[model samples]
Target: MRPTFLPSLIVLAALLLCGCDAPVDHYPPNELYSLVVSTREMVSTQVAADDTTAVVEAWFGTPVQPRWPADQMSGSAAKALVRLDNLERAAGRVYADQDDLHFGLYNEHCVTCHGVSGGGNGPASLLQNPYPRDFRAGVFKWKSTARNARPTRDDLIKILQHGAAGSAMPTFRLIPEQDLEALVDYVIFLSVRGQFERELISGAVQELEYDEARPSDGLSLMSIVGGDEESEALSFARETLDRITDGWARADDAVIQVPPETVADAASIQRGREWFHSPKALCSGCHGQDGDHPLALQTNYDDWTTEFTSRIGITPSDREAVRPFRSAGALRPRIIVPRKLSDGVFRGGDDPQTVYRRLVTGIDGTPMPAVNVSDQPSATGLTSDQIWDIVHYVRSLGESE
Candidate 1:
């Protein structure tokens, strides 16, 4: 049976009202969601007159525009914009029709926390201990690929299917597969669009002319606004977009090639337990003696938490620009608590192969790092065979569950 309203949902509904005492049946008018592009302009002083802009130009190029009656934009940038528009259209249809069940399913029930822009600062995001992921940054923690590589489509779908344990992210196994597919596509669209927005700001800083007079304001988006420079910017943007898209496209090809599972004999499990405490694998460093390791410090942070805290007050001096409402007592940043792994469900994925990748790639943005595997026999570093043994041992913990 479908679940009734949940406590989290109630909190979300209150946030949606923004302190307004609105009736439950009062659904806000459905609005077409669009990317909230950053408006901060780049100063010429930030970019030297002869600075190498190939990187920025490649990634951010020209702003997205419409065809003919619309402004000019890079082909790739336009594609991203188009994809987002298409998704917005689809989501809007469901929202407008008041198909709350299907609409919630359509979005993986994420809009409440992720916001329509996919920015981490969703309305309800602030209420959650760890904010909902901001897709714009394009830095995913649970991925099998290299630290910098985009996550595979399957990587994303798996999270949707199983959800991230110990977090608000919930498994949508009951949702229709087609709905999940649409949600994934929409997420990717937001990510691409968000990345493009970042690049565009960076490109403007590097590629535009700097007038010393307006030191703080930097270059207006209109500066160096036409001719070959614009064309070059657009070309660069398209190339960069293609590269980013291609990375996601090729992620499946980069999966770690694991050998088939081996026999889980007592000896192999024992060996794994030994390796777990070894200096190299260092599983006990965080997982503790029996999986419940006491933290060295009271606060432990993951990548997102680290980034969010570091940028407070410093990145954008205007506090209002980042956070809108807050009491003085709430200003102190909250710290992320690392999971007690003894519980046995890996947040990334539960399968052996997924665990193997986690060992190799490390969870991005957290203290967890990729383990170095060497074929040579040593007191430190592990061989592929040794790593597999550890995997078996770890799985054994789950058997009790």
Candidate 2:
């Protein structure tokens, strides 16, 4: 009465034959499996600094332009304008007019801590425990590479997108994707323009040094025998300026695509909440019991900022040195500073994925440690899904706070 073995055998054979041409595996193609773009491919065509203004007007509608004295305009102001123009173009449609974009982007995000002109003059800049950057000099403290030299465009992008783990520069991922790109472009434009201006002034000083020397002029106490000869010194100074200018040109001209927006989900938020409160994770210590609690938790504790700085090997003096150069405003309760998450600083600028990157990787040289929950059987390091959830939670915090 059961089905006959011969019929079943015939059916199985037919099914197998039909499926033979079909793929046995359901996995995606190799390329689709990995979304990372190679660095070399990402490099953009170089645009000339002189052409930037034309490009800006062509791309984005004209708005009020900043007026600088004719003499000042020849130097950094011109460069800043060019760079700003180029950035506006690359950022697509977010920036209406250059000045408006500049004021809006910098004021709400950077000026609160770094000050309007980056002289560390912003209201909150004064209150920061460490102070803000003075953009006039163009020196940066936290850099991507170990050398701590000038930051690359990519470096700046990373900092903007993810924020410095222990610093007040909140991850800017929350900014609309286009807006974030525009912001990144603008920041670099400012730094490059500022550096160029500084270099021009430095060149003038070097010229003065050369003029001061006589036929019998000897090396100063600072320039001993091991130092460069006069000709070499002149060459070196020129070369340094050349390098800075060249960097500006390249950075201004390079085109970069904005990263896509990352949408947050629910499961990740639940997990993130747990991790935030867990002793092993220790995020709750500073962030507070429920992340909204007012009492200063270990994570938020003033001492932790110092400890975080030490862990990253950043000296207090170094923090002070760069404080004035920051164009972004003060690191306050609501403003981001070198340490502390006053306001929703850490949660402010960035998107879900960027937040995930910060949580997973921690920062290169700061107190924020990598959160690795993979080892625990009961918990798992946040998957992409979980990270999105955390993003929702963080965003919710913004509304509630």
Q: Which structure among the candidates has the greatest TM-score? A: 1
Task: Give residue 184's error in model 1 in angstroms.
Answer: 0.7
For model 2, how many clashes? 39
**What's the lDDT for all of these models?**
0.57, 0.41
Top-lDDT candidate index: 1
Off by over 4 Å in 2: 1-117, 122-133, 136-190, 193-230, 238-266, 279-281, 294-350, 357-386, 399-401
lDDT for model 1? 0.57
Instruction: Give the Cα-based TM-score of candidate 1 against the true structure.
Output: 0.69
TM-score of each: 0.69, 0.38
**What are the per-residue Cα lDDT tens digits for candidate 2 across 208-301?**
2322222122312122122435643334334544565455444433322223435544564566577567765666664566566544333332
The lDDT, on a scale of 0 to 1, for candidate 2 is 0.41
Quote the positional error of residue 2 for candidate 1 in Å.
48
